[model samples]
Target: MAIRNPMYCGKIFIEKYKDEDCHLVKGLHEPLITETMYYEVQDILDGKKRKSKLTIMSPSMLPLRGFLNCNRCNRVLCGSASKGRGNYYYYYHCSSKCGYRKKAEEINKAFVDELKLYILNDESKEFFKTAIMDAYIDATKGETKDKTNWIVEITELGNRITKARELLLTGDLDGSDYKTIKTESEHRIAVLEAKLSEAPVVAVSPAEVERLLDKAIVKLTQIDVIYSNHDTYVQREVIGSMYPEKFTFENLQHRTANVDFLFQLIYQINSTLREKKRRASDRKTCLPIVAPEAGLEPATL
Candidate 1:
């Protein structure tokens, strides 16, 4: 939910690269969060962070209960209802004293409306699908560079790990310090090793890509409908697939996703579409799309 990366606090970040611990040390960049402020933020986040409640509730009107949290204090919303004249009115309130409350119906409708932003028409959808398929298959052909980088990373981690153990044995570094570096180095090694051990990805055929894109287009177009039809738990699961972190909700609106690259790509395409206009004679318009991580090769068509 929060990115309190220690690198922003005037720290050189590496597990076993520096002589000291992996935490903040003197760095060239200006610190964003002071040591005191960093600790306070950590305490607050640690205290507030909690696993989403998984208890399956029976048929209920408030299906978006645990899917949203308090925008102010990051607390799971509590849903309740009160009998008003003949019908019951439902609302979601923050557990903390944030004075934040919104009608359940409004939140649910707003969330569904928000999901509509991802829907793309036939042309744009096909363009992105082709770009993605090309990138995926292209990655498989020239993977030697990636494999070499992984091998170098694994070798560095191994060397650091060996040095850390020798320092601990020679009494140059204390057991606690050695353990910290060792754990960090081991984690890095394990991750790289797993990647190295995996079978190489075989490129999908042209027909397969077509079928995959057809299925994807169906899913993309029906995202909102699928989300609306599901129960609260399943709805949240759909949201979690796209947004791994908990998003903020305030002023009767859900916050925009910042970390999800898929959403970012969609936004860029939509923005380009909005900025361009034709003479109404030629309907074809081209938008340049780029994603370095997904094979930086840009597409313009």
Candidate 2:
């Protein structure tokens, strides 16, 4: 009762408790503890709070534990080891009452196969690298101009604040009006200063950019190889980058997984190019260029 009482934190109710006419007085006595700590204890007694410490995953197993969704209930799957015949077996299962489950070995193999689908071929890798470099160049083209503009605006706002101060000193502007102008100008200057701070000190060199792109391309092209050779942490990172959203496993395969946008773009372009090349070698059989019907319709008014 004392743990739930506010009087322990130096508060007192003078009138009827919790009544509209009740008057509550705080600091009636010296507090033995802070009000925050007292309320937190009350919350625990009421079962309204729990420990906020994060539960760490096993670093050597079940890399896809929270990433996999149960096919039946769509809840994030949990993994655990089960003992049978004096041997331990691992499985990913749903916490819900749906009773969905799968062997960890099977699910892990399926995810590795899924990664193989996004691996870029040699031609696609080169094209993807070039496209990314070109886009980066175009994006950085106006970066210098942006920094200059932000710096100019910040300087102008600072001058405005100074002018407002001068007006207030001379009594040309009312104190309230001068204060308003100063506050607004200062806010604008702060925003512009933040943007200037984020700007790079020097432009990146083309050679340096190319070197980075080459390394990234290699990673993208050999993603499965890297995932297979890495530890659980790296494997989880690969899964996260490939599928930002949780995916379901059914029929011994991953289903409804959303590939990352960059990987999707690379896969789409490569597939389209392959289709075009295939059609070019057999143009007569392909009828995508022709209209649906044999007869032509009348012109619209």
Best by lDDT: 2
lDDT of 1 by residue, 1-301 (tens): 4456765566665666557665446788898877776666677678864444677662356766766678778888888898999999898878787888988778767766766776655556866776677776677646656778989998998899899889888999999998899899889889888987794755566678779778877777677778778776767666666665655555326446443666556656655665564433245433334533544665443
Q: Which ten residues in a row have the lowest lDDT in candidate 1?
A: 279-288
Over 72-124, each residue of candidate 2 has an lDDT whose tens digit, in order, gives: 98889999989999988889999999999888888888887767767887868
The true-versus-predicted C-alpha distance at residue 220 of model 2, in Å, is 1.8
User: Against the true structure, what is every candidate's RMSD?
Assistant: 22.7, 15.3
lDDT of candidate 1 at residue 264, scale 0 to 100 = 55
Q: Give the whole-model CA lDDT for all candidates, comma-separated.
A: 0.70, 0.80
TM-scores, all candidates, are 0.51, 0.56
Q: Between which residue pairs do clashes occur in model 1?
A: none
TM-score between model 2 and native: 0.56
In model 1, state the lDDT of residue 77: 82
TM match of model 1 to true structure: 0.51
lDDT of 2: 0.80
Candidate 1, superposed: residue stretches over 4 Å from native: 1-60, 144-210, 230-234, 251-255, 278-301
